[model samples]
Target: MASTSSNKSRCATCGKNIGTFTCRGCSQDFCLSHAQEHRQLLGKQMDEDVILMHDQFQQCLNEQVKQPSLHPLMKEINEWEKQSIEKIQLVAQVARQKVLNIISKHTDNVIIALTSIKEQLSRARDDDDFFESDINEWKENLEKLKTDLNTPKAITIKFDDKMNSFIPKISVHKERPITERFERFLGDIQIEENGQLITHGNSNAHATVRGKGEYSSGQRLFRFKIENKRTS
Candidate 1:
């Protein structure tokens, strides 16, 4: 017991006869008073490290809020969308106008024919012997009615939707009126948080995104990649 006590280190700061504690970090032996001082100094260093990390986190969050409203890729996407919608609108308008014109032509012809038939039927109902004298004429009028009923239905409006050829394809089809036949959409669209996208319209498409922090300026840099997509 005497040998073990004598071999132990003495206080580093206080030059005491014996030391009760040894610092784990620096391997320095100290009396009670000096040991407490060392612990407080280590704690201060740890607190400084924590505060530095906290400040970095807060700065990153603030930069997100201050980010620009439009990125280069975003602008490109907006232009693409605008052009696509305009094309769709033009096609729809042409189809609508054509269908209306056909309907108008048929309506006018049908009304004139029906009005003539109504006059003949009214005269026959007033005079019971009218058909008896002009049975052949009545038969001719009935044959004309049959001809009108058998008019050829040649014109029709059809919807054909297509999607971009890039990484994700967006295919749109003409949906029939909401009747019993619920025509399903032909394509799908999927987007990820990191700017990756996948879609299928007429075919498959994909996109990728990359981002980095500009350390010197505290700004963000972004890049986008697209594949197999046609803008319009």
Candidate 2:
């Protein structure tokens, strides 16, 4: 009977004797001696698989702490900063050229007027036939010309206070309403009123506009009001 019972069940590892203990997790039967060996093997596997993975994750965490700028999001922010600076430089270059051109033209006009006054004074001085009334009139004209030369009425510098900055602002939000403004547009579209208002610029053609924000998922809502319409 003992021989028959021992032969009926065999150890999973040794496969020669009856299996006394069965692992509830693996469902494999083992003899008393091999059961302890199987538990030891499981312990070794836990160290190799679980604890080793944890150590590897810890190393990644340490690297993140040392160099936060290595993140992908940081790279995107850096790119945005670089592009914003380039835009500012481009606008400044155009503005500088415009102001310089205006100043040159204004100076040429002033010099032309001054030359006319100079010729009159020179002719009168040589002739020596000018009266006090003529002298007072010439003096008054000279003073007016001097004032015009110092301060040209045509040159005016203005800043748009509604535009807080030439570069648009960015922020992070959790389900909060995001502000979207028109960025790039084609055809005859005009962005006005601090970027909140959009108006059609031309009556002849159609206009298309692209917004600043992009969304992959989530419900979004947009609102617009038609303030006025062009007649004809």
Candidate 3:
């Protein structure tokens, strides 16, 4: 009976004799010596597997820290900033060009008027026919030219207050409609407090002071508080 039983069962590893134990997990039978060796081999393999997985996880973490992906919204905001600045710069350039052109035209017109006056004065002096009236007229023309050169009433800056925009729109106007209540004035008048107030001097007692604006058709109301007045 003993010989028959021994022949019926054999060691899984060495196959030298009948297996003394069977593993519950793998369902493999092993002799006593082979069972201990199989347990050691499984423990070694478990350690190697743990080490490999740990290394892989660490590599993944390092990669994540080194090269993080930028958010989509961040890229979008950057592009918006670039485009907005470019647009602002372009508008600024255009404004500068317009101002230059206006200044050039104004200077050219002044020069032409000055040249005509100079020719008239030279001819009158050469012929010795210049009267007091001619001298007075030349003086008046020169004074008007000086005033026009100093104050460029044609150039007006407008701002769009109706629209709600990230950047406000500013425009330069050559012949804009007179919108403000008091913008242009003639005589010894001074504009103060950003055109909110006007002061007149009695430099010419007989000369009439006139405040004027070009309007096709409109009913306008004006209110003024006299800060100071001179009765001479």
Candidate 4:
């Protein structure tokens, strides 16, 4: 009777108790047919997982391959940007130098012209002073001559031995013309420096007498040339 009862309690497929036959691999209790089916399902699930892992690994490798190719291009672009910046800076520096050079030249020319004018003005003042002194001396000499002529002295004066007649003669003439004296003064004038003289306007021809022995005939011609150039 116990054997009969045990037989009735076992699974029909595997001839074992329904709960006693458990698969160690899957940790599930089942009849033989159901166990076999469960193993098949597990194997299929593992295959799907392996395929998914292989696909993911392939994707990672593809990404790595693309990165190596792109890296050199990115580096080249960065290097080009650096070189472009350097070239722009160099061009700007060259332009700045050119502007500075032009300004320096302009300033130098202005200084030279100003110095020339200043020197010419100084010479003109000296010439004026010399002319004034000469005129004063000439006046003093004329006054002395007048005083000597007015003095009265009685004496027997004979024009000819037969005719006893006295005649008073007076003559007045400039010992030296002012124009000729001025020209002589201009000729005596000299320039200390080795620069040509420049005149301002066409009002009058004024001699620029620098000092004692520094005047030149070329300076006089240069002044005339300046006047003509300005008028033209």
Top candidate (TM-score) = 3
Worst 10 residues of 3 by lDDT: 204-213
Which has the higher lDDT value, candidate number 1 or candidate number 4?
1
Give the Å shift of residue 146 in candidate 2: 4.2
| lDDT (tens digit, per residue) of candidate 4 on 119-221 | 6557766775446655565456456444533431111222232444242222222222111111223532433224344333444455554322334453322
Query: Order the candidates by TM-score, highest first — what do you get?
Result: 3, 2, 1, 4
Candidate 2 lands at a TM-score of 0.42
Question: How close is every model to the real structure, measured as TM-score?
Answer: 0.32, 0.42, 0.44, 0.24
Give candidate 2's error at residue 101 in angstroms.
1.0
Q: Which should have the higher TM-score, number 3 or number 4?
A: 3
Question: Which stretches of candidate 1 lie above 4 Å from their native place?
Answer: 1-69, 129-154, 160-232
Model 3 C-alpha lDDT versus the unseen true structure: 0.76
Weakest lDDT window of 10 consecutive positions for candidate 2: 168-177
User: For residues 126-230, what per-residue lDDT tens digits would candidate 1 score against the true structure?
Assistant: 886465546677677667656654552434434333444343322222322211211222235444443234444544444332222223554433334457767
Error of 1 at 122 (Å): 1.3
Model 1 weakest 10-residue run by lDDT: 175-184
